[model samples]
Target chain A: MALPPYAGPLETTWYYGFRFLCACIFIFLITPILVIIPLSFNVEPYFTFTEGMLAFDPDSYSLRWYRDFVNNTQWRHSVENSFIIAISSTILATFLGTMAALGLSKSHMPYRSLMMGLLISPMIVPLIISAAGMYFFYSNIGLDQTYLGIILAHTALGTPFVVITVTATLVGFDHSLTRASANLGASPTVTFFKVIMPLILPGVISGALFAFVTSFDEVVVVLFLAGFEQRTIPRQMWSGIREQISPTILAVATILVMFSVVLLAALELLRRRNNRLRGIV
Target chain B: MANEIIGGDVVLAADGTPLKASLNKAMRKNRIRALLLVTPLFLFIVFSFLIPIVEMTFRSVDNWQVGTLMPKTTTALAGWDGKALPDEPVFAALIQDLQAGAKAREIGKVGTRLNYEKSGLRGMITRSGKKSLKVKEGPYKEKILKMHKKWKDLETWTVIKRNTAPYTMGYYLNAVDMKYDKSGEIVMRDENRRIYGKLFLRTFAISMAITLICVMLAYPIAYLLATLPLRYSNLLMIFVLLPFWTSLLVRTTAWIVMLQSQGVLNDLFVFFGLVSDDNRLQLIYNLTGTIVAMTHILLPFMVLPLYSVMKTISPSYMCAALSLGANPMVAFIRVYMPQTLSGIVAGSILVFILSIGYYITPALVGGTDGTLISNQIAYHMQKSLNWGLAGALGALLLSSVLALYLIYNKIVGVDNMRFG
Candidate 1:
C-alpha cells in the first residue's frame, strides 16, 4: 500500500518503521534456509565460513561434502528408499483420497462430517502418538520394520491432504456438466474422464505433490516402523545429525532446500491454474 | 423434473414405476454409490489408523505379565490377606509357578513388569525363579523367604496380588507421577521421581511461548503481505512458503548450523565484538535453541491463516475509524485488530497444538532442560522398552490434542484448512 502523504512527521516515521519491521520478520522467516547453502560448500568442514571463502577464494570452497553424500552407500540406499516409499504411498493416497473426496463432496453423502473427521484424523493427530500406536499394532501383526507397513502408514497420513484439496476443488465444480454428458448418452466413466478429470486435474496433481512431500519428509513413523533395511532419507539424516556432526548433512540440507523450492514453485503454478479454471484469477 | 406429476395427478417412469417411487429409488442409489466409494478409505483408516491408537490406549492398562506367567501363585495369593505374608500352600504354589516360568524363560517378563511397581522386585522374582527350580520339597515358605529378603516384606505380596488382574492401572499411575505406597493407597511419587508431571507442564509452557512469539512475529508480516500490492506480495510469500515446503529435519539442521557456538550467528556476534571469541554464546542444545528453531519452523502456520483473514478485511474499516477522529493506533487496535482475532486464535491454536507434540526438532536441539513430553514418550518406546508407560503418556497427550482439535474444528472448520 502507498503511504498517505499526511503532513505529520510522526506518521511519516511510522510508515518506514513499519516496513522495516516487516522486512526484518521476512528475513527471520527465510535466513535459516538460505544460510545452509553457503555453509555446505565450506572446505574446512565447519559450519562457519572460512576467511578465504569470505574473501571470495575459490580454494576455500569444495564439493567434497556433496561427494561424500553421493559416495556413501547408506545415503544412496536411503534416497532410493525415500523415493520408493514416497511414490508408492502417493499413488495409493491419491487414488483412495480422490475417490473418497468425490463421494464426500456430494450432497447425498451420508455422515459427511463424521466421515471426513475419521479420514483426516491421521493428519491432525500428533505424529509421535500415531507412530507409537502403529509400532505396537504393526508389531503384533508382524508388519513392523517392513516397507509395506511404512508405506501404508504414510498413505494413511497423506490421504487427508488429498481429501481436503480435491474436495476444495470440487466445491467450484458444476454438476450440470456431468448431467449434460449423461444426457448426451456418455457413460459415467466417460463423463469422469472427458468432463471432470480435466477440470480437477490441477487439484489432484497438487494433492499428489502434497502426499509425496509428506511421505518424503516424514521421519517419526519411519523411526518407529523402519529397521536398517528400510531407512528413508529423513531417517538417515536423523542418525547423521545425532551420531555425527558433519558438513555432509549440511550438504544434504542444501539439496533439500532446493528440492523444496521446486515443490513450492510447482504448487504455486497449480494453485494459479486451479484459480484460473474456476475463473477466480 | 422427470418425476413431476402433471394435472392428471399421476406420473410414471418408462419402466411403469410411480414417479415418486422412482425418484426415491434414484436418490437411494446415489446415496449408496457415494457410500460405496467412501467405504474403502474409511475401512482402511479404521484398521490402519484408528484401531492402532485404540490398541495403544488399551495397552496402558493391559496387564498380562504377572497373571499369565505366574498363574498358580496368582490364584494362591487370591485367598491370602495382603496385610501379611502367606502360608506354606501359597509358598508351594509360588515355587511351582516360578519353576515353570523359569523353564519357559518367561519369568524375566514378570520381573520387569513387577519392577515397575516396586524396586528390587525384578531381581527377587528372577533370582527366586532360578533358585526355586532347585528346591524340590516341602516347607517352602522359609526357603523362599531366605532366597530373597524382599519376599519377607509384606509389600512384595501386595504388589503381586495387585497385579493379578487382567488389567492394572499401575502404568497409568506411574505416568501421572503417582504410585501405590506400602499401604496400597495411591500417593504422589517421591519428589525426585516425579518427572512426567514436570515434563507435561514444560511441554505446555514451551508450546505457549512459541505460540505467543509466532503471533508477535507473524502479525506484522502477514499484515504487510495482505496489504501490499499483488506483485510484491507474491514475491514476498515465497519466504513463507519455502520454509513450509522444506523438510522438517532440514530446517532443524539449518538451525543447528546457524545457532551452534562455532556457527554463523555466534561468529557474527564475535565479529561485531558483541562477545569475545573465548565466550561464544551457547545458543544450540537448550531451551533457547528449541524455541528459536520451533518458532522459525511454525511461523508459516501463523502467517498463512492470518494473511488469508487479513486479505478479506477491507481497508475501509480502518479508514472509517481514522476519519471519525480516532488516532491511527486506536483505530487499528479497535477495528483492525478485532477483525483479525479469528485469525489470531486459529493460528495460535494450530501452532500450540503442533508445538506441544513436536519431537524431532526438540530431540535434536533441546537438551535435558528443553525436551518435551513427546521426547520422553519416544525414549520410553525406544530405549526404556516401557511401551505401557509410553502408551499412557501418549493417551494423555492425545486427549489434550483432541480437545484442542475439536475447538479448532469449531472455530476454523477443518474443511477450510489450506496448504501452500
Candidate 2:
C-alpha cells in the first residue's frame, strides 16, 4: 500500500537511488562480519596483510588458526563452561517459562497483562542491576562463583525469552483439543502429557533453544558474577577483545556464527517436523 | 432444528444428554490445567527472582546495623538537629555513639556509603565526621579544631551531626539529588553542580529520537514487503532475520569496524573518488553513529510487526476506493495506511522501549556523546559501588517503562501483541 512519490525522472531516480542505497548499506553493514569467515582461512598472522605478499608466492588459505584454537586450553575451557551453562539454563528456563505461559493464557486470571509484564521485566530490566543484586545475594546462598551460581543467574535471565516464545505459540493453539481429550475419559495429567504437550512442544523446544542461546551469548551479567575459571565464551571473548585486538577473536567469532547457524537450522528442522510429532503424540 | 441435528454431539442423540457431570468435569480439568501450567512460573518468581529483589529493596531503606544495636540512641538522634553546635549532653551521647558506631563499624560506614549514593556526600561526610569526632578533654571547641579544622563552621558541624543521626533521610534523599539540613529539611544542592535531572532528560530525548528514526526507515520497506510478491518478500524477510541470528557482539563489532577511521566504509568512499584521500569522515565516537547503527539493528524490529499487520489487509479496500474515482494516492492514503496504524503504534512503542534501555549500542557507537541513562546506571553499579543510586535510577526506568506499557496495553491491547 505504499504510495509512489511521482512519475518524474528526478523523483523516480531519487527513489530508485534510495532503495539501492538501502540494499547496498545492508550489504555493506554485513561485510565486516562476513570478512572474518574468509579471513579465518588466511595463512597470515596480521589481519590486513597476507604471508604470501611477503613471500612473493601465490596466496593460500588453510586451517592453521582452527587447528590452534582446537588445541588451546583457554578456548577449550571457555567452550566447556558455555555448554554447561547453556544446557542447564535452557532446561530450567523452558520448564518454568512454558508452565507460566500456559497458566497466564487461561480464561480467568487477575491482571494477566500486568502479570506478563512483571514476569518479562527481567528481560527489560537493565541486567547490570540484576547481576549486581545476584553478586550480593548469591554470596550468602553459597552459590556465588560456582557453576550453580551462573546457572541460576542465567536461568533467571533466560526464562523471559522462553515464556515469550511459548506464549506466542499458545495463541494459535486449538483449546478444544484439550477439552476433547478430557471428555474422552483421560485424566488431566494424562491429557496434558498425551495431548496438550504434543501440540505446543515445538514452541517449548524452540523456547528452550532460544534460552540456550540467550545464556550462551550473555556477557555483561557474566562479567559481574562469573569467576575467571568459570567464565563463559562471551565473557572470555570480551576479555580477549579488551586486552588484545587478536586475530584469534575473529576466528572465534566466525566459529561462533557457524555454531549458532547450525543450532538454528536444527531448531528449524524440528519446527518443520512439528506436525509429525503432533500426530505421533 | 436441522442445523442442530447436523452439529449434534456424537456421544448422545436422544434430545442430547443433560451432561452436567461432563461439563463440571471439563471445568475441573481446565482449572487443573491452568494451575499445572502456571505453577512453574510462580515458583520461579518466588525463589529465583522475587526473593533477591526483595532483599535489595529491604537493604535500601534499612539502618540494619543501627537497628540491631543502640536502638534508643538512633531513635533520639533522629529527632535532633545540628544547628549552632550541640550542647554537652549531645556530645556525651555522641561520644558513646561514635565509640559504639566504630566498635561495630556501622555509623560512619552508612554515612560514607550514603556519600556514594550522592556525589556531594563525600565532602559532606568527611567534614561532618571530623567536626563530630569526640573530644576526650575539656575545651571541646579547640579539641574539635585540633581533630579537624573545618569543624569550626557551625554549617559544617551541622552537616556532620545531621549525617550522624542513625535514622535519617541520608540515602534515599541523596538518590534523588536532594540533601538534608541540620533541621532535617530536604533541600536541593547548589545550582552550579545540578546534574541528575539534566541526565534524566537527555536520556529520554535520545531514546525518542532513535525510535523515530527507526520507524521512518522501516515503514517504506515494510510496506514494500507486504505488497510485493512472495518470492521477493521472502528474500527480504531472510535478510531481516539474518541480523537476529548473529551475535550481538559481532553486530556491534561490525559497526565499530565499518565506522573506524581505516575501515571499509571510508575506503569505499575514497576508492569511488567521491571523497579525497585522507578525508576525515567522522562516523563513530558520536551520537550520529549511535543513532545510525542502533537504528540499523532495531529496524527489523519495526518492520516485522508492520509487515504482519499489512499482510492481513485486503487490497480491495484501496481498489474499491480507486474505482469510485478517488485518486490512487488518496485511496491508498485513506484506506491502506489507516489499516497499518496498529502496526505503526506497536512498532513505535516497542522500538522506543527497547532503545531506551539499550546500553551496548550507545556505549560502542555513541562513545562519549551516546551515553544514555542506562550507561550511568551501569557506571553507578560498577564503578561507584553505589547500589542505592543505581537502584533508584533502575526503579525510575521501570516506572516509566511500566507506565508507557500500560498505556500501550490499553490503547493497542497487549493481547494482540505479535512477534513475542
The best candidate by lDDT is 1
After the best TM-score superposition of candidate 1, give how far the Cα of residue A260 lies from its true spot, in angstroms: 1.0
Interface RMSD, candidate 2? 2.9
TM of chain B, each: 0.97, 0.81
Residue B101 of model 2 has an lDDT of 58
- In model 1, which residue pairs have backbone atoms overlapping below 3 Å? none
Candidate 1 residue lDDT tens string, B26-138:
99999999998899999999999999999998999999998899899888988887767889999999999999999999999999999999989999988999999899898
* C-alpha RMSD over true interface residues, model 1: 0.7
The numbered model that scores best in TM-score is 1
lDDT of 1 at B362: 95
TM-score per prediction, in order, is 0.98, 0.84
Tell me, per candidate, how large a share of the native contacts it keeps.
0.88, 0.34
| Candidate 2 chain A: 10-residue stretch with minimal lDDT | A46-55
